[model samples]
Target chain A: MKVLATQTKSERTQAAILAAAEALFAKNGYERTTLRDIAALARIDPAMIIRYFDSKDALFARVATFDLMLPDLRTVERSAIGTTLVRHFLRVWEGERGNSGLAILLRSAASNEHAAKKLRELFKSQVMPALKYAGADAYAAERAGLVASQLLGLALCRYVLKLPPAVTMSREFIVAEVGKTIQRYVAGDE
Target chain B: MKVLATQTKSERTQAAILAAAEALFAKNGYERTTLRDIAALARIDPAMIIRYFDSKDALFARVATFDLMLPDLRTVERSAIGTTLVRHFLRVWEGERGNSGLAILLRSAASNEHAAKKLRELFKSQVMPALKYAGADAYAAERAGLVASQLLGLALCRYVLKLPPAVTMSREFIVAEVGKTIQRYVAGDE
Candidate 1:
């Protein structure tokens, strides 16, 4: 019973560290955020972070570990794919769960090499496989690249840069406008 | 004659400082880079940077100053406007003059609020005026926002993140693929 109790406490501590790390990374980015800063925010000894996560790079990898939770596009309606995908992304970014992992990765990717690599990996591992639904055989890679550029660009403008127009845009408008662009990139003829 | 010589030397020093600041800002980003670092790279005393630029914020504003040099889009053939604009951006980014100012802004924008504000200002000042050619009227701001998303995303993927597919795409291919999107954004029926 005591051992189980100790394990539960350890797990809680680990969770706290990850939460603090994610918040700091999203706010300050990878290069500027330090283990000491994370530890301070987590209310734990700095060494505790080292014990749990091994290294800053490792901690960041863990924080940035996210599943796009991409629905199998093969199952989505052909014409509705674009709107469905856009709505899904909206939920991923603004849903109750929040998109801290992606937000952290994007915030750091501009200046941090590690974050950039992870983003590319996410594209390969998550985005590429999903595009198989588009049935774009020879142009699959390019199609996926186009989709990424539009989605990521929307995220950058609305969330990071917070450009007035992008920020003020209604969800319905974004869904209609960006949705059409994604539809073309994914399914339009060359 | 002495006064004229002094002014010439001062102008030379100012140019050097701007160049060094641009490089370091592009590399280390705004928050991490220091005036001392810029001075070291420029081979000038730190105090000289202060004398020339006043402050780091002011120095960065100067470094980030860029004119998109947009063409009068209304004059271009309606069918060819997208290709013309994409070609122009390709030149701006990869041309001999280089795109250091824009690169510096993108690199620093994620983590620095000031840099992000500067980017929004650039979008307002340069991009919006150019989109007047699209004659979007009621949808002008939305149209400009969409254009910014696509172009900035291309820059982020090809230049900053260096995503493989985006980077490997040929100029001709990019012009074709992205040009269609921009044309749709600018002129397609909502």
Candidate 2:
């Protein structure tokens, strides 16, 4: 099912296109990135981009966009859920593949109306639904908002601003503290 | 003196320039704001921008920059400090006149390296030093980082992303939850 190694020429071309778009979008942002730039980066003709994705938005949706499906919180112990969430969120933010797709969407929110809409949608569908199913409840919404504010702010301070103390904080410490804080937000006084 | 009785031409010019810069930076970001736009908005010669601030960085330093100067935690009521802090943060983010500075700086973070550097400087000099002075010790560095992450993440999700729950959260509730969470981050239990 994994297509055992060698990709077809078209497949390789598509991957190359996606890779280029990701890098460009991550570095320059969504509004600043043009089809010409993606083509330039991918070494493909501009026509091929339209031929494949039809438009910039479609290409962006495929390349620089995504939903972060959180792991099921039901299976985990309630007390540990907050801490577990902290760890998981950190993993999502600082995952091995360099910058995250969510990070890109977040950065793009200020400049691109479309990106902002997508960011809102990700929260409505993927994020809140999952938390609701996890029994976080309606009262938990504000707390979740507060938690999200702090977590995303930390990501911004650490990666984007590169604030020293934030930049210096170890992942283990971050996971523990942030996990506990999120626990308090979503679950309430323990 | 309140200076409300006498609005000097220079003061009006300065105020107008700052307002224009704030809106443009918030919308288009630091890199995208043009001196011509600021001058046109202020109805001053573009030459005056160079005369007043020297450069965009200088203008930004004067206009779009601020720091969080936290009060001494040990002296304040421990239970109330968190709520107070969240409230203050909210005020800074939502302040009618000067608040957009944080938003512009945040938006410019990815594209403008100088803005990012200035933010780090502000954190180290203002936030870190204050937290350290209040009671944060050797391990305080990382703790503050975690707290910032939580706070900023929540802001980005709520304000920048406009996530539903984040968007709808009342100011009072956010302060209660976020403030308490921050307390735990800095000085409370595991």
Candidate 3:
């Protein structure tokens, strides 16, 4: 019973560390944010973070996991696939989940080599599979890349850089317009 | 003649500083690349950089100009506009000019606010005008934003992250495929 109690507390601490680390990493890009800052935000002792994570880099590796909870392509109507995907992504980014994992990955990928690797891994695992499922064949890999460029670019301009036009664009407008571009990228000629 | 000689020497110094700054900024990113490092690379006194540009921020502003010498939209065949733009961008990033200004901007924008601002300004001045010139009136701004996402995303993946699929794609393949997406973005219906 005592060991069980320790395990529950340890799990709680790990969850707290991950949540705090995500918020700090999202608000301040990787280089600027430190493990101490994450500990402070999580209201835990800094030693606890080091003990649990082993090191800042290791903690970041855990933090960089970008499971996007992407909707399976088989479930959506063929004609509405692009729009549905766009809407789903926007929902994930804007949802109560708050700062999305993809956002943090996007923010840090440019500056941190490890984060960049994770970002690429996320794209390969999460994004490419969906495109393949949606009927992309030999060129699915390339088509998925094109889609990434568009979607990632939008995230950079709209969320990260806060460019005026991108910032002001409504969700409906973005879904309709960017959705079309994504549709072409996924379904268009080779 | 005496004043002209002095001006020429000053211009040369400024050029050298800008060149060194761009290379360092691209390689190390913004936060890690400092004025002392830039001075060492340019083989100039650190004080000279301050005297000429006032601050590292000022030098960075001068260095962030992303002039692609974009072809006049009026001259290109209407049907081939997208391919032409994609080809031109690819050439600039991969050309004799060495590290493209856009590449540097992209590398730093994620971490530096000033760099992000410069990126937004570059897009506004360089990209939007081309879309307007191509006859996109009502939705030119939005179209430009969409186009920015795809091209910038390509730069991030191919140049910044070196994603395998993104890096290996041939120039012809990228231009043809990405061009179709851009064509639709700039000319497609709402």
Candidate 4:
């Protein structure tokens, strides 16, 4: 739920804790980041964190839940479905949020079990449903996996690995090129 | 050069160190893994690790040079190039080498600067050259980056993240399906 224009003090505290936790987890995977560190950054009492989210694990789950807010693919032209999905994700990754919540989950997954589980769950709950909802009834899971390969790979190289060529690609070029491949995975023949 | 059957005592020791180091680095990543851990696993004195390689960074560089041994894309049928590349990579990844050197490089890249630089260099020297040699000269670097997105994403999901669908995918099915996408990135019109 969007925080109302007049925010309650508790909700503001929760927001502060989440922002601090996400940045620390992103910078140093889950193992090295601690509640004390998060509390320090958030400027809240450590006990306040426990009262708000119960524990570090619970807070992590809350932080990791990301909605891609994919366009209703069923409403899009069947031929343009792939490009639309690509464009939407590009914006999500590059938006004012900078590294989206999903980026934190992915970056932390390499060394943290909780983050890895969160990553898989995010795919199952959020990504797969969107693909299936868009009319990829047959092999929807497989198709989503294929799409994940492309999208995650782009994120890794451009965002994490910071490979130069990938970092420099124009947004229009990435959408047109990556969209075609995703289009095939979503709607093209085997 | 392949180590000859007539290897000296020092050569044998160096080989043992590399094998142990690769396994440790692959499982624990570069930061959590230490020289002592590698030496214990290799049954060599820890000093020998420094004696042979001078430092963990140098030892890691030696272990991280993976050879994909891609087939000549120029020789491959233009229509079939993608599938062929996919099939070949599948073999390389699933080969007796178990976790390839690239896997270690990838796993370590997130937290280690040396590993990340080595990954970029590997792509520039090895993957980009092969793409250029295959007649992707016009957009070799960009094309290589696109291919890297698919291939690295597959490797991350299947090997590192161990995503169920990615891990369980039949070799033939992945080749047929992901290969189509790679083929597009490699030779398709921009």
The per-prediction tally of clashing pairs is 0, 18, 0, 0
Q: Clash pairs of candidate 1?
A: none
Better of 1 and 4 by lDDT: 1
**Candidate 1 vs candidate 2: which has greater lDDT?**
1
User: TM-score (chain A) of candidate 2?
Assistant: 0.66
Cα lDDT for residue B25, candidate 1: 85
User: What TM-score does candidate 2 reach?
Assistant: 0.69
lDDT of 1 at A38: 98
Q: Which digits, one per residue and each the tens of the lDDT, describe model 3 over residues A80-112?
A: 778988998788777766645566567667756
Interface RMSDs of the predictions, in order, are 0.7, 2.1, 1.1, 0.9
Judged by TM-score, which candidate is best?
Answer: 1
Candidate 2, superposed: residue stretches over 4 Å from native: A1-63, A96-99, B1-34, B37-63, B67-69, B72-74, B96-98
What lDDT score is found at residue A100 in candidate 4? 52
In candidate 3 chain B, what residue range of length 10 has the lowest lDDT sum? B53-62
- lDDT, candidate 2, B43-62, per-residue tens: 89887876665456556655
**Candidate 1, lDDT over the whole model:** 0.82
Candidate 4 lDDT by residue in tens digits, B1-190: 4556789989888889999988988789767789999999999999999778756755776675577787777788788888888988888888765645566567667545566788898888878877876545577778889999899999989887878778888999899999878877888753
Q: Is candidate 2 or candidate 3 better by lDDT?
A: 3
Task: Give the best candidate by lDDT.
Answer: 1
How is the predicted docking of candidate 4 categorized under the CAPRI scheme? Answer: medium
**TM-score of predicted chain A against the true chain A, for each candidate:** 0.71, 0.66, 0.69, 0.68
Order of quality (TM-score):
1, 3, 4, 2
Computed on alpha carbons, the lDDT of every model, listed in order, comes to: 0.82, 0.69, 0.78, 0.80
The residue-by-residue lDDT of candidate 1 on A1-190, one tens digit each, is: 7764677778989989999999998788777899999999999999998777656765786675678999899998888778988998888987677445576567678666767888899999999999877755788898888888889888889888898888898989989988988888888753
| Pick by DockQ: 2 or 4, better one | 4
Q: Show model 3 residue runs off by greater than 4 Å.
A: A1-34, A37-64, B1-64
